[model samples]
Target: MQTIKNLVKDNMRQYGMFIALLLIMLLFQILTSGILLKPLNLTNLILQNSYILVLAIGMIIVIITGHIDLSVGSIAAFVGAVSAIMIVNMHLPPFLAVILSLIIGALIGAWQGFWIAYMRIPAFIVTLAGMLLFRGLTMVVLKGQSIAPFPTSFQKISSGFIPDIFGTESIHLTTIIIGIILSFLLTFLEVRKRNQQTKNGLEVINNGLFFAKLIAMVTVILIFSYVLASYEGIPNILILLLALIIFYTFIMKKTVIGRHIYAVGGNEKAATLSGVKSKRVTFWVFVNMGVLSALSGLIFAARLNAATPKAGNLFELDAIAASFIGGASAYGGIGTVPGAIIGGLVMGVMNNGMSLLGLGIDWQQAIKGLVLLLAVGFDIYNKNKSS
Candidate 1:
């Protein structure tokens, strides 16, 4: 009993938002008369918010390094417009366009990073300037018109699905098989992690709690897979998102650069004294953000099948909200990739749920604002309590 209490207490910040997410889902599930969890609705939810989630992933890293990027939405819009011009006007191949767009995004990141890192410009001011500059550039590139009819191959990046090898009707056997494999893999990883901790004489969670966690995770994965399988199977974008989440999670948790990011965010002076290259780290982090912002723009444009001047408007707000809601600290140096993903889901679910309930867009925006305020407030409260 004490162990369980301690576990919850220690991980309250990490688990609090997750539990809130479940409760929110449950509330909407009842309010929407069970439409909230329908397979089709669930699938649409993932598709609709995919871009914002991508931005959230990048945003969390930036926040962890004690910075913000207010220009991501504009960057996304600008990149989308540029890609449309390449693919639609110049008749470039979709794959080539994507590669060039990502490179362009990286260069934009480098531009802003230079000012913020080397020139000592505040990120807020520099990115604010970037926001205006890029939004204007997007409009100029599109000539105030939306570009449409993206190639079928490019559209598939957002709209396609993985084909089932098993070829079973009425259910997606491939999704289920993937789910089972994932469950087994997760179990193996958890056990291996526990073993490593034990070998190193580190304290391990109680066996009962650990097993319970594993069972719960596996069950959730299976049920989620079943839900998606009942519909049109997993979307291609979901696979992309999963890969990104896994990669970023590993990077943040395992890599030396990841440690350096945290160290720098926690204390730049201390980190610099400890041999970390704070400027270079900050520069690279912004560059990475630019690339992600570009990827987000591409995803949004692909999903819409058009590049509009307004495409990605207010996206920076959504990404920032997700990072904070996911448990990233305002003061920097505290967050996780998984936490940011959960935060994005929370926002997505709320948006979907409110729409289903026939709530007005005005109310949705207001509610989301309140939620963001509360989430950040909670973080500050926790920080104060801990201190």
Candidate 2:
């Protein structure tokens, strides 16, 4: 019993997320008459949640730095508008348009970063103003209208699946193969890393902990891969999104800069005293958010095959909800990439399930509101308990 307690304490963050995900799934499965676990519905859940996941990652970083970005949704709309204009109206090459739009996103981030970091303005006010400003700007750019029927190639960024050149029909063997290889490779690397830690005289976790984690990961991957492989091939956007998740997870886990960012979020004065460049870190965080907002915009436009003035309505709420639901603190200084991902999935699943049941949108939103309140309440409780 003591060993089990110690094991849980040692990896509480990981286990907490895993347990939360399972609990949520179970709750929804029971509520939705088990349709929540159906393979088709699960696939839909992933696709729907993909965008919020993108924004949640950015929002988590922003929140980690003790900052809020109310403008992400507006930025997403603006970026989507810009991408549509560049590709469809201006007749630019799709790939080049994408690249340029990403730069524009970076520039947007730089714009907000400058005001917040160098100007010493409150992030809330800046981002709030930006939220409104960008929404209006998006309208102007889109001429108070919606632009649709973007090129097929561009549309595929969000709506298309990986090509299945090697498949006979109905299944993409390549995707399954990729999933299997990826699963084993990831497992192998984890084992190798732990073995290295043991050799270095580091405090290696008990073998039980390692096995528990591995079993959890393999189960998740196999289930996810099986669902996707059974669908219309793996969604390209999901693949790209997963790659970004892995890359950012590594950045947060393995990089000093990532640590500094979190420290700044945890305690600005302490981090500054410790020789950390809090300003630069905050600036980069916003800049990174901008870039993601841009990518999200392009993907949104592509997915709808239309650029609407309301492209990212309420996206800020979704992103914030994802972060907190994933275990971020309202006061900042905690949260993980995987946590944000799970949070996104949680919201995604709820929305998908509610919609499938033909529940009134009002009820769907009411439930989400209750969930958000509960999540924030949990954070406060945890924070006070720790204090």
Candidate lDDT (C-alpha), each? 0.95, 0.87
- Candidate 2 yields a Cα-based lDDT of 0.87
lDDT of 1 by residue, 224-332 (tens): 9999999889999999999999999989999999999999999999999999999999999999999999999999999999999999999999999999999999999
Per residue, candidate 2 scores C-alpha lDDT tens digits across 43-154 of: 6676677777899989999999899999999999998998888888998899999999999999999999999988989999999999999999999998999987799999
Identify the runs in model 1 with alpha carbons over 4 angstroms from their true place.
Answer: none
The candidate that wins on TM-score is 1
User: How many clashing pairs in candidate 2?
Assistant: 0
Report residue 346 deviation for candidate 1 (angstroms): 0.3
Evaluate model 1: give its TM-score.
0.99
Q: Against the true structure, what is every candidate's RMSD?
A: 0.8, 1.8
* Backbone clash numbers for all candidates listed: 0, 0
